[model samples]
Target: MKSSPQLPPGTCDCHTHVFLDEAKFPLWAARRYTPPPASIEALTALHDRLGVERVVIVQPSVYGSDNAATLHALRTLGQGRARGVAVIDDHTSDAELAAMADAGIRGVRVNLEVDGERDAQKATQWLRRTVERVAPLGWHVQLYASLSLLGACADMLGSLPVPLVFDHYAGAQAQLGLQQEGLAEVLKLVESGCAYVKLSAPYRCASPDALQSQEPLTRLLIDRNPDRMLWGSDWPHPQPGARPNASDVCPPFEVDLGKTLNALASWAPDAATLRKILVDNPRRLYGFDA
Candidate 1:
């Protein structure tokens, strides 16, 4: 295996998920995909090897809205280096939100592409409420939805006092291409400063017929909004429909981590820009300490 990329000082993996043992944290009964087991210890080792200094653990949909696993990992990795994004419902109490904030959780995630309708209205309401409660604490709302859904949310998002972080290049893909009308609206949001985007999942956004064709689209977004850009690993990747297998057996779909890190630098064309994507941007957005 190739050695992990040696990140610059203060580097951060801005987006990723940790799937724990189901014997302990049972998978959601309604999960759309079965994720392979992943752990904080394993992630720490990955980070150590990669030379990444910080990370933001986004709660996966397979766990529904339960954030206990994410919270516990944040507590254990107490270098003041890790933060988290959680999924919550409207019924989540003010105290619970505050507790999460104290536990290095600086954001809440609302996922859109799950197998079934997962209560978008309630999730939006929860985000609205949580944003109000966490405003004093400087937290943001991390949104995991397609470009179309994000376009719909753009107007409503401006009313929130916190920042909105978009995942997976705002879910634009080569198949949709630039002609994807919804992405134009997204670019406007990024331009208006209401949105931040992660340059993760370039593979997901690539055309199933041709992966190399994705570069132009990814580079376009990077050029358009370098300051608001971020990078992620999406580690222990949960490929849809495939049976879950060990990393050694399945090997994370064979993308080159070192090359991915290099691509971020190439896209932005500056060391400081890449650092901001890897470090400062995520730290400020997720409230990780320096």
Candidate 2:
């Protein structure tokens, strides 16, 4: 139980999820892979142990637009201690959106990568439309898209009605290194303060020497704009995943979260920068009380 690399006070794990009772919050038929029960109780204990004071429960792609599970987690955690980012379809009503806002949801997620959708044009369209939909709620749009898709549409970032939140390094390809096309654009977006990037799931984009390779990647964002950065455990980190029709389950990745925080400290320019990433930024982005 080494939660060594101490987390700062008011530190928020900005990107995490909890998959509770499937009977009540069933998975979508079109989902890629089944996830094991990663409940709020487990999440709370883990956060408590790690010294993280606040959390943001992001809607996992497996649930599609059904946010019951995410909302449940937020309620169980209680306000001031937790907030959420939900997933919604065109069918979701304004009343429902308003209800979610009241329940402490601060954002909506647009996950293009999970659907295996490679159409950069379509991805950009979805993002723009999602921004329009959630804009009225004053919620930022969180995107989980590939760097290639992202690279093709960086020009569109400046014109969005709402702020953008990039998940998992904005789909940067660790192996691609300098060849990661959207990397520069993402850096610029952070620099311009039009978007926020989560320094999360480094293992997802890891190269052979993952630790060494991930350093520069995380550092680049920290260096460009620490104010716009967020750090998340991406807890219960699921494997890459299988087809929509696949019957098998995707087990989570094993990570030493405390050590990962330490690594983030190394990437950030200073202690205050780390605090900005872990505390100040998430509070402002999610509307947590001071």
Q: Give all candidates' CA lDDT scores.
A: 0.76, 0.85
Candidate 2, residue 243: Cα displacement in angstroms equals 8.4
TM-score of each: 0.87, 0.95
1-290, model 1: which lDDT tens digit per residue? 35544578888888878877778887777776676678989989888878888888889887888898898888888737788988887777878888898888887876766543345465567567767766776777787777776666667776778888888888887777687857887888787778899888777788433546667776777667777888888886657655453222233455666667665666666777777788878777776667
- For model 1, the superposed segments whose C-alpha errors exceed 4 Å read 1-6, 115-136, 207-211, 243-252
- lDDT for model 2, please: 0.85
Indicate the TM-score of model 1. 0.87
RMSD of each: 3.5, 1.7
Error of 2 at 208 (Å): 8.8
Best by TM-score: 2
